[model samples]
Target: MSASRPATTTAPARPAGPGGPGGRPGGGPPGMAAMAGPPQKALNFGPSAKRLLAQLRPERAAVALVFVLAVVSVGLNVVGPRLLGHGTDLIFQGVIGRQLPADVTKDQAVENLRADGQDTFADLVAGMNVVPGQGIDFGALQTVLLGVLALYVGASLFMWVQAYLLNTVVQRTVFRLRSDVEDKIHRLPLKYFDANARGDVLSRVTNDIDNVSQSLQQTMSQLLNSLLTVIGVLAMMVWISPLLALIALVTIPLSMLVTAVIAKRSQKQFVAQWAHTGALNGQIEEAYTGHALVKVFGRQREVEQSFGAKNDELYQASFGAQFVSGLIMPAMFFLGNLNYVAIAVVGGLRVASGSMSLGEVQAFVQYTRQFTQPLTQLASMANLLQSGVASAERVFELLDEPEQVPDAATPQTLDDQPRGRVEFEHVSFSYDPEQPLIEDLSLVAEPGRTVAIVGPTGAGKTTLVNLIMRFYELRGGRITIDGRDIAELSRDELRSSIGMVLQDTWLFGGTIRENLAYGDPTASEEQIRAAAEATYVDRFVHSLPDGYDTVIDEEGDNISAGEKQLLTIARAFLADPAILILDEATSSVDTRTEVLVQHAMAALRSDRTSFVIAHRLSTIRDADLILVMRDGAIVEQGTHTELLERRGAYFDLYNSQFAAPDVEEE
Candidate 1:
């Protein structure tokens, strides 16, 4: 179910420059503490007024047509009432008030005219022997009635057309907006995803966009139609009787004030409701993704309790928002009823005193009702509009986020035959500057050699590889590929020269061949099989019911962990990069699978500079060089035998893993 939340804060005022708060150029607020708040105001949505104006894009053309049609429709409606009143006045003067011509009494003139017409008709119909004076003309009455019908028909047709056009525009515009929002989510930087929970992001893209779409599709056209109708009705009311028009308008300002107050409160509630929905979605996603772990740990009750809290929060928020927004309709209706009663009472007294005609009073009442009808609709739809605005603000917030590190303007391609030499000069890095993960350090890996990085968790082993691939930029220092600074090389070109296989294997939802082809999209079927065979994944894949055509489920859950690792190896094999980084690539496999993977690695390492982050020292025992790292710095580097002889961190790590367990004596 859809839910809403109160807005916690006003949207931020636009900054004069890209720099926010302090004077630092392009920097966010002064410190990390400032980041904790309601999501930053959408930098690109502009002021609230501007955002409202932007919403008009959907109905601009429709609005113009509505204006023209309303003017014409109102003119026609007014003309009919005025003509009917004139006809009534003429009848009263000629028949009831002795205001006819003085040539004869009213009855005598009517009799004489009827007799003359009957004789003339008898002369013309002599040959046919037709009867005379059988039917009355009543042409004036018929003409007025037909004219009124025509006017009503024209007004209704225009109204229908206007409604259709407005609604069509609203739906189309909203569809495009939703599509654009989804596209932007995919284009956002990886760091954004890291900072925000996946569930929250998904909620924004789906729930928030859906809310905006629904509001537009359901309420926007009604709003436009009502607004035009109200304007037209008010104009007719003034034309009918200025005094009654003034009485009807007296309640309008009061109604608007009441609506404004309610809208402000409802807008806040809607914002809160939306936020709670996001929180609830986040909780649900966490529960499902970790279902296996939660069940294994017997944390079902705890999970349920957490879910219940979030569910209750959402319920409260949604109910409150709806309840508050719902108030506008009744409030407006109350005022509209008051205005109607006032107009009816005053118009009745005027007509009774002969100050206004019966027809005029009738038309006046119709106009007053028309005026109230649109106002009522506007009050109701204002709630939807405010909710839509809140959703738009969230969506724009994502689109407006700064893309800080764009690819280079002019990128240099890597050499086709790269020497596989990598060097880091004075490199320092951090996820947050206050807590540096890696300090100023330098390292080198030569051509066609294996380099094993051994470090405790969080010692920056993975960070080093990430930097080499330019996934994250260094705060200080430069990294070079084949003697060329990596920053100058095209990002695509730099990455294409490197291959990585991590501990966690990610196979997308596709056939085995498709997953392998991801590494080299143009690779032939034979080449793909060769890569799979090299990694020993082909044996298991071929055993599957569909062989290579078998589809992998999300996270590769359909296959064993060992098989997923093998598939990843197959991908890397197909990539055939000049440089390879293996982060515990064989850690998940069994002894047999590890031996097979080791063989695959041996084949892949030829003429490639390989960096292996090893947990099991036995896997990298044959490396050409081993770098024992501690606290993000290399402590020792040499062949495995040389490091063992030195008896340093490497020797200690190797002994811990390969050391025989003590036997118990009975």
Candidate 2:
């Protein structure tokens, strides 16, 4: 009876909607949009990226500290080249000075050369800070070297600290994000799951979240370092020689142009890539979940073809995103090289003319390299940053899904002693507003009575049960228990008093005793065994090697269907609910097991309000009330003999099965 049925006719299908993947009914691709192929751009890159960044808001202080550390580290690193250049000047000046005559002062030698028509050489000598006959000063050189080492050490220490803090902030932020997503999932309505693929939702929860974590971890600190390094290096370059600094600056625009062009093209591809990943995951999940069905129907090839199509789409999207973003690094490298050559030629000429010292030129070259290197690094990281943001957008989309209606702010409670007298008055409902499933239906089940519902497949049998369970809201009218409107009571409190055994038995991977305890967590071993015995579960369970301790497999395939059904009934008994729902509970068991199950059912149903949905008429022959349903309406209601005497819908349905067999025997 819980078997998958189309939406009730009361809720008719809506007209084709405007949004969702493939314009699916209800909404698009569950909580996400569908992707057919690579798009030209992301749907909302700016807002999604902003939202992703917002995840760091709670860690703003830690992030700020990391930024400060990065700045200090870059500043210390920037001074290293200048200090080294000073040492080089000291060594060069000493070497040049040592070769000159010891008797002549430094200025006297330069003036003598100017007097001898060698002013060019004199000017070069004048620019040098050398003693007339001095050799290399090991003491000064040692001091400079030590200072450079200290700067590097300090920079390294700060960078290490920055990295530690950043990792902490990132992990904590992602941890909270993961927790929020998990909670939000539970809050989503059942219809959302029914409309969306499980694999797709799983990809968003698991894969996309992981990608966001990795992206932030890999890209955040490095991007900050590169940017700060660029700024610090540029300042040093300008201080040393503005002319050469200007040459390096030319590459900035080139780098920007390359990044903007390639990143713009690649962002869309990255979005497509992630979208395809979700789609592929969905197909794989569906394929594996129904592998046996596919094999039995001989449709393996079709499933394979579908998988191949989705896989190919993912590959294409990945290739396009990677190929486009990949161009950024190379282009930046080429432009950087060109800038390097220009600065080298110009600096060398300035040094020869004595307008700039040899050491100054050396420092400028170092600065040029530092400036270009970070630009290249930034270009290379564009792909990672884009990819991470793309994944974040997908996750954000899931978190943004509309949640189910909220519980009442002040919920009413059932009486301590529940009577289980359920009444449905003028109830109208539908899955879609355009269609009607149940309209103005009224029924009253007095306390402790068994009401049997018999109908064809689409007669809204399960729908009625779902209403009592409040799985969906009513369009009009209300359902009440003990005169208290169900809508006023909290869902948890309302369902706590009811027990249900569905046609499709569900058993988790656990010991038999543990599964039984699931019905009532506080149930003791003695109570558990009592329920098991009552449901006839104690019979087969003892035959197993471990008895109650025997573990059920993940799929619960270790036990027969009948055994599983009995376990569920035992679980229901353990719950000791005031009301019970059995949806074709005995349909799976053999006739002999059915007889045993009937005894258990009778015991379980004692002094409890019971709703039995059955296809086999004989199973409910002794039901207190037999309701014949047709097209979402109750056509007849009476005891077994009274319905037969009426010779109406119930009589015709009954004779259709039993009368045919009698006629054949005759």
Candidate 3:
């Protein structure tokens, strides 16, 4: 069999270069590295994180409500400890006051003790605020305890409400992000997909976006609450004692230093971890897609080795990221403990000196814990934020990809009566600007004619059809259908009028009837069956247990290749298009099935202009016109007999195929 060049935009492959990482043959799969796209090394945490937050703008009202709730909750929680400390002071005062003589005032008792050189005991009694005549004020203690209980309950309620609102905001923002990514994928030019790996793109759309969502869900509410707690607790500490507040402030710089150092190191590892994750996913997709080919070529060992290397790279990156980011919590905890000790010693001294009440000191101690706990939480969340931002950068990169050129501002429409007359005028194109593929290529396919394109490999036959379809913008000149420039017509309008079937069959996971209807969504059952019978798809479909209802798996491996080809042909026939393209459409079918499909194609070609790209010389013998291409140029053109008589490029190609098989070449 003779084959033409593949319709790929990549540069030609380099000869057996150094094996990639693990001594893989031909670099795993042809152009695997290119498919993986570019590696992301640098991370912009600040900008990406800000942009991620900006996704919540649409839910701004909800976010504001969450903020308010967090503040209220943290305020109530802060007030609770102060009130409980007051209750503690009350009980101590009651017990001490009861022991005093009923006739002696508290001041007199403290003065007498001081005169006796028991000043420490005197100061302790003064700090407790005991009245010599008072005893056990159970009523006041119960009221203070009730107030504390109410504050705690209110705080819990507000916290729960805040969390609920934050969850909604996060989910909504992620929903919009996913929708945006999905829309961006559709708008991106085909060149992007051709240049990048399917798995990597999928990772950004699936894994990366999912990571962003999870990160926001896990961190947003707690982060908000923690920050508010820090502020609220700090205020309470200052209210209790300025000196103790100053002592706690001493640890702020240390906490910042620890977070900055550890987070800086972990950020890079987080970036690497996600990058390697995308690379590994790309490899997995490629391997799974071509599992049969790998076995056939006996390159499984190379593939496995390549996989192992990528997997190990991901593992190391993930471990480094987790291990390094893990340091922030412990370091912050240590600083917090040191701050706690300082506050405790200073508050104790003040209490002993009778300069501060025991209740005030106890409350200040509680405030110190509250303050340090929030700082600890914020430090711990740094790692989560870093990973989330790394994933956000990737998703943003995709969303920022350049989109396909917009359709014509004023689109042209075809007449109700269709005539398929395709003309390529002074057309030029190339996969790479430096390496020209097709230049000054011109052709005319009259209505109701079968124009066969025959060429050796790399001769640009398929590229010609791609140009007609406007899959790639031409470097120069124009293509027209029925005297109207195809560029003027919207892509949708142009494509709706044309039908294409490639050698590689694509059938989505659906019943046979559903797949057939894909070519014409509005096509009736009768029309589908008619096309199927015409292309002989009905013959095999009926043999199945469910007939037309038989469901095809995702890979469509349940059916034979030839049967799949027949289904595609039937689909094209059902389209009833004005123009048709068959890029080696019959290559996969057996000889007998090929004959049946050819007859069906001949019937479909009536009154339609069809471009058939084929490798078999015998197939084009009956074509209305045959064009021979060589190195992206049309070298010969005419009827089969006329070309043979001319004894030109077509003659050489014909003899090469019919003559003693000179080691068949593509």
**Best model number under lDDT:** 3
My TM-score estimates for the predictions, one after another, are 0.82, 0.90, 0.93
TM-score of the candidate numbered 3? 0.93
Model 2 lDDT at residue 152: 99
What is the per-residue lDDT of model 2 for residues 1-666, given as tens digits with 9 covering 90 to 100? Answer: 111111222322322121211122233212333333334456476887788889999999999999999999999999999999999998888888887777898899999878999888787788888788889999999999999999999999999999999999999989999999999997886557666677878988999999999999999998999999998998888888888888889888878988998999998889999888987888888788678789999999999899999898889899999999999988988998898899889988887677888889888888888888888888998899899999998888789999876778898888786879888888887665655657777787878888899876666677677778776678899999988899988889998988988877889999999999999999999999999988889999999999999999756889998899888888988998888988888888888888878877876677888999888898898787888777667777878888899999989888877884645543
| Alpha-carbon lDDT, every model | 0.71, 0.83, 0.83
Where model 2 places Cα greater than 4 Å from the true spot, the runs are 1-41, 112-121, 659-666
RMSD after CA superposition, every candidate: 11.2, 4.9, 5.0
Arrange candidates, best lDDT first. Answer: 3, 2, 1
Better of 2 and 3 by lDDT: 3
The most accurate candidate by TM-score is 3
Worst lDDT run of 10 residues, candidate 1, spans: 1-10
**Candidate 3 overall lDDT versus native:** 0.83
Residues 250-342, model 3: lDDT tens digits: 998889888999999899899989988998999999999999999999999999998999999999999999999999998988898898888
Looking at model 3, report the run of 10 residues with the lowest lDDT sum: 14-23
Candidate 2 versus the native: TM-score? 0.90
lDDT string, candidate 1, 513-609, tens digits: 9999999999999999999888898889878999999998877888998889888878987998999988888877899889978987887797899
Runs with alpha carbons beyond 4 Å of true place in candidate 1 = 1-49, 52-172, 175-183, 660-666
